[model samples]
Target: AQTVTQSQPEMSVQEAETVTLSCTYDTSESDYYLFWYKQPPSRQMILVIRQEAYKQQNATENRFSVNFQKAAKSFSLKISDSQLGDAAMYFCAYRSAKTDKLIFGTGTRLQVFP
Candidate 1:
C-alpha cells in the first residue's frame, strides 16, 4: 500500500515571498513517480512539477521546485516569488510505474496575500 502525507493543512505567504509545503509518501516500490498538483477556485488540477524516484536531481518548473529525498520518502514543494494567483489547494500525488495507480494526499491550502 502507498500513501502520501501533507503535514501542512494550510499555509499563508505574502506576495513575492517564498513558501515550502511539506509532503511525505510511503511506498515499497522503487520505481515510481511523484507529482505536485495545484487546484484553484476553477477546480482544475494543474500539474506543478514531477519527479522520478530514480532521479537524483530534484524537479523544478518556473517558480515551483521539489526537494525529493528518496531515502526518507519525502517530497516537499517550494514555491518562489509567491503571487496571489498562487493561492489554491496543492495536492501531493504518487504513481507506481508497475501498477500505474495514482494516490493523492489530503492536500494543503495555500493563501497568498499582498
Candidate 2:
C-alpha cells in the first residue's frame, strides 16, 4: 500500500513571504508520481505542482515549487511570495502509473497573514 504523510497540520506565512510544507511517502513501486493539490474555500481541487519519479529535476509553477527527494521519498512544496489567495488546504497526493486514483495526505492548512 502507498501513502502520503504530512506531518504539519497547519502553517502560517506572512504576505509576500515564503513557506515550505513538508511531505513524505511510503511506496513499494519504483515508478510513481507525486502531486500537490490546493483546495480553496470553493472546494475545487487545483493542481499546484507535480513531479515524476524518474525526473530528477524539481517542478515549479510561478510561486509554487517542489523539493522532490526520490531516495528519501520526500516531496515538499514551497510557496514563494505568498499572498492571501494562497491560504488554503494543501494536500500531498501520490499516484502510481498503474492507477488513476490518487492517495492524499491529511493536508496542511496554510494561513496567510495580511
Candidate 3:
C-alpha cells in the first residue's frame, strides 16, 4: 500500500516570491514515478512536474522544480517567481511502474496574494 501526505492543507505566497510545498510518501515498491499536479478553479488537473525513482536528478519545468529524495521517500515542489496564475490546489501523486492508477495526496491549496 502506498500513500501520499501533504501536511500543509493550505499555503499562501506573495506574488513574485518563491514557495515550497512539502510532500512525503510511504511505499515499499522500488520502481515508481512521482508527480505534482496543479488544479485551478477551472478544475483541470495539469501536470506540473514528474520524477522517476531511478533518476537521481530532480525534475524541473520552468518555474517549477521538485526535490526528490528517493531514500527518504520525500518529494517536494518548489514554485519560483510565483504569479497569480500559479494559485491552485497542488496534489502530490504516485504511480506504480506497473499500474496506470495514480494515488494522490490530500492536496495543498496555494493562494498567491498580489
Candidate 4:
C-alpha cells in the first residue's frame, strides 16, 4: 500500500514571500504520478501541478514549482512570491498511471498574511 505524508499540518507566509510545503510518499511502483491540489475554504479541489516519475526536470507553473526526489519518494511544493490568493489548503496527492483514484495526504493549511 502507498501512502502520502505531509509533515506540516499548517503553515503561514507573508504576502509576496515564499513558502515550501514538504511531502513524502511510500510507493514501490516506479512509473507513477504525483500532484498538488489546492482547496480554498470552498472545498473545491483544483489541480496545482503534476510530475511524472520518468521526468528528470521538475515541474513549474507560474509561481509554483516542485522539488521531486524520486529516489527519496519526496515531492514538495514551493510557492514563490506568494499572494493572498495562495492562501488555501494544499494537498499532496499521488496517482498511479495504472489507477484512477487519487491518494491524498492529510493536507497543509496555508495562511497568507497580508
Query: What is the per-residue lDDT of model 1 for residues 14-49, given as tens digits with 9 covering 90 to 100?
Result: 999999999999988999999999999999999999
Runs in model 3 deviating more than 4 A are: none
| CA lDDT of every candidate | 0.97, 0.96, 0.96, 0.96
Candidate 4 C-alpha RMSD relative to the actual structure: 0.7
Per-residue lDDT of model 2, residues 6-114, tens digit only: 9999999999999999999999999899999999999999999999999999999999999999989999999999999999999999998887679999999999999
Candidate 1: residue 72 lDDT (0-100): 98
Per-model RMSD to reference: 0.5, 0.7, 0.6, 0.7
Clashing pairs in 3: none
Each candidate structure's TM-score, on Cα atoms with residue i matched to residue i, is 0.99, 0.98, 0.98, 0.98
Give the per-residue Cα lDDT of candidate 3 at 20.
99
- TM-score for predicted model 2 compared with the true structure: 0.98
What lDDT tens digits, residue by residue, belong to model 3 across residues 1-114? 899999999999999999999999999999999999999999999999999999999999999999999989999999999999999999999999887679999999999999
The TM-score of predicted model 4 comes to 0.98
Candidate 4 segments whose C-alpha is farther than 4 A from its true place: none
Candidate 1 wrong stretches, greater than 4 Å: none
Top TM-score prediction, candidate number: 1
Predicted structure 3: clash tally = 0
Prediction 4 global C-alpha lDDT:
0.96
lDDT, residue 49, candidate 3:
96
